[model samples]
Target: ELKVEQNPLFLSMQEGKNYTIYCNYSTTSDRLYWYRQDPGKSLESLFVLLSNGAVKQEGRLMASLDTKARLSTLHITAAVHDLSATYFCAAEPSFNNDMRFGAGTRLTVKP
Candidate 1:
């Protein structure tokens, strides 16, 4: 079974500040994905990290995966109010073909 843990469930940041959200998984995974969800909105795909040390960035967000450590990170640079949302990280293990997701991190960017 695969399990995921995300820390600091809630974050409040000022605009122009930076932060990083972490996702840790138990078990080996080769594929990982990041997603964003706004209040009352469906999830939006952010990034797909396919290999160890893989990194992807879009806008002010960057996601990276470390397969060997069973961990992934999402870094937000120069956060903006428009970036406020809930973020989730999911990992798919090679053995079971199943994906497990972290509890999610809710971020609020203030002006």
Candidate 2:
């Protein structure tokens, strides 16, 4: 059985601060995706880390994957109110098409 875990499920920070969200999986995964969901909105793909040590960044968000450790991280730099949303990480194993999502981390950026 494959399992995913995310820490600091709820985060509250002031604008312009920096934070990181972590995703750890129990087994080997080929890739990982980071997503963001606003209130009452659909999930938006933020970043896709494809290979070991793969890193992707867009705007204030950056994502990295360490396949050997079975871990991934999403880093937020100089966060803004618009970035306040629920963030999720999904891992896709090499075996099948199945993807497992970690418990989302709900973030709130205050002014």
Candidate 3:
């Protein structure tokens, strides 16, 4: 089976609300990354977690990696209409550079 999994394939949030997305991997990996994509748009880089306890944030998003637990988290703070997009978390195995992405969390931020 693929190494990574994410919950809630779809999410809808009202403006000013908050939510957290979870990512779990089946095996050890060297890196974890998060990305966002708007409708019909390319991905926008969110965070890159390279080691255990690695955390990064930009704007309304925050991401963290726990290599020991083979998990990652993407927390969204204060949703907005503009935040409507699909969020994906990917994991790269320690032995290889190829990364695998989650099915994706399709978020809709209502006005």
Query: Which has the greatest TM-score?
Result: 2
Which of candidates 1 and 3 reaches a greater lDDT? Answer: 1
Q: Over the stretch 1-111, how does candidate 3's per-residue lDDT look in tens digits?
A: 447899888999999999999999988888898989988999888888998999898989889988888889999899888888899999988788889999999999998
lDDT for each of the candidates? 0.92, 0.92, 0.89
Worst 10 residues of 3 by lDDT: 1-10
lDDT of 1 by residue, 1-104 (tens): 88989877999999999999999999888789898999999989999999988999899999998888888999999999999999999888888778888999
Order of candidate numbers by lDDT, starting with the best: 2, 1, 3
Tens digits of lDDT, candidate 2, 1-111 = 679999879999999999999999999887799989998999999988889999998999999999999999999999999999999999888899799899999999999
User: Where does model 1 exceed 4 Å of error?
Assistant: none
Give the range of the ten consecutive residues with the poorest summed lDDT in model 1: 92-101
Model 2 pairs in collision: none
Write the candidate numbers in order of decreasing TM-score: 2, 1, 3
Clashes of 2: 0
Give Cα distance to truth, residue 65, candidate 1, Å.
0.9
lDDT at residue 11 of model 3 (Cα atoms): 95
